[model samples]
Target: MVKLTLIRGLPGSGKSTLANTIDAVHLEADMYFVNQQGEYCYQPDKIAQAHQWCQQQTEQQLALGHDVVVANTFVQQWEMQAYRDLANKYQAELEIVCCNGQYSNVHGVSALTIANMRAKWQD
Candidate 1:
């Protein structure tokens, strides 16, 4: 069985950093929408496409008996539930790490970090 770790947090909350620390394949949500040049923003259709792609990638990785770490701000309940359902469907162990913290107290993360992350996912 595969293990799926869902790193959920706000932008600049170090989701990717945590994923890297765990030595897991970091699947950034932005990668689904951003082009190579990082110019075009995410459209509604594109966002949907990216989500489908992520689902497929997760399935593929699990099928290969590899762990998958999803790095994204799964702020919405629906989003988190979707990941949970996927893990259940695949018979993979689902681990959700909520990186929720007060912006004032979160160390090493500044307003600039949040701004930069928002800019990358700007539509």
Candidate 2:
């Protein structure tokens, strides 16, 4: 069966790590910031664009009938709406995985940013 797994967590959590371990096409909004030199350059102004790219990539993979794993800080439920809709459209089994492990995030997100996300986090 086709599957789409979404890993959600705050920065420093194990979302990306868990997503990597899954046998599927791994995707994340953070990926949109990675330059050709294999470096991550985060631009706050492009955050929404990054998310749109991620969603489009997910839809493309689903269209090709590939299982996909997307890791993002979906702190609020609304952030996941697009993925949920994609899963439905593709008739893929959808799974939401929450990772709360305290592993150091590769992107070096600030504690303040993490705190703000935690404040608005939903179950």
Candidate 3:
């Protein structure tokens, strides 16, 4: 069995930093949908494909007895439930880290704003 740590936050929310600190396999959703140049260049058709790839990678890491760290803005309840289902199916422990912080003082975005952005992004 593998351990899954789902780090949820918005863009520039330090999800990557947390993933790095844990030394776990980082599955960055932004990398799939956004470019390093901070551009949203992903095609709608490719989103599902990219998510599938992420799921596969997570499973592979778990199979190898490695902890998987999903660094993404999973702000929706359904999104978090999906991860829970995945963990249950794989017999892994699901750990959800809600990366919410003070947006005014923080250099990154806020979880509430991220959630709103995600809702719009999905629509």
Candidate 4:
């Protein structure tokens, strides 16, 4: 039973941490923050590209009949609609995981930014 899991919350809410532990093909837009040198260099300008890449990878994995997990700060309902559509298209179960605990995010996002994200987040 392939599942499309979406881990949602603020930057420091452990979305990525939980995604990493999943056996499914975990995909996160932030993974694109790593440069070719394997260093974390977040390109704010490339944010859209990162998400596109993540979604593409997820589609590929789903085509292969694999479960897929997308970890991102899906702070609003609209942010998650695409994944929901994809799951429906593939006839896969959609699972939404909400990470609420605040901690230091792996991407080193500022606490202020995390707080803003939390404020923007909606169930």
TM-score of each: 0.70, 0.98, 0.70, 0.93
Clashing pairs in 4: none
- What's model 2's TM-score? 0.98
Angstrom error at residue 112, model 4? 2.2
- Candidate 1 has its poorest 10 consecutive residues by lDDT at 100-109
Give the per-residue lDDT of model 3 (tens digit) for 18-69: 7888867888654576677777565767866777777778878887888889
Worst 10 residues of 2 by lDDT: 11-20
lDDT of 2 by residue, 45-87 (tens): 9999999999999999999999999999999999999999999
For residue 36, give model 4's deviation from the true position in Å: 2.6
Instruction: Evaluate residue 16 in candidate 3 and report its C-alpha lDDT on the 0 to 100 scale.
Output: 72
Local error of candidate 1 at 66, Å?
A: 0.8
Highest-scoring model, TM-score: 2
Off by over 4 Å in 3: 33-41, 101-115, 118-123
Clashing residue pairs in candidate 1 (N, C-alpha, C atoms within 3 angstroms)? none
lDDT per residue as tens, model 1, 1-123: 788999877765667678888855667556676677865455656766777688778777877878899987676657767678778888999888877554442334467856665555421
Ranked candidates (TM-score, high to low): 2, 4, 1, 3
Cα lDDT listed for each candidate? 0.71, 0.96, 0.72, 0.88
The alpha-carbon lDDT assigned to residue 58 of candidate 3 equals 81
RMSD to the true structure for each prediction, in A, is 6.8, 0.6, 5.1, 1.2
Best by lDDT: 2
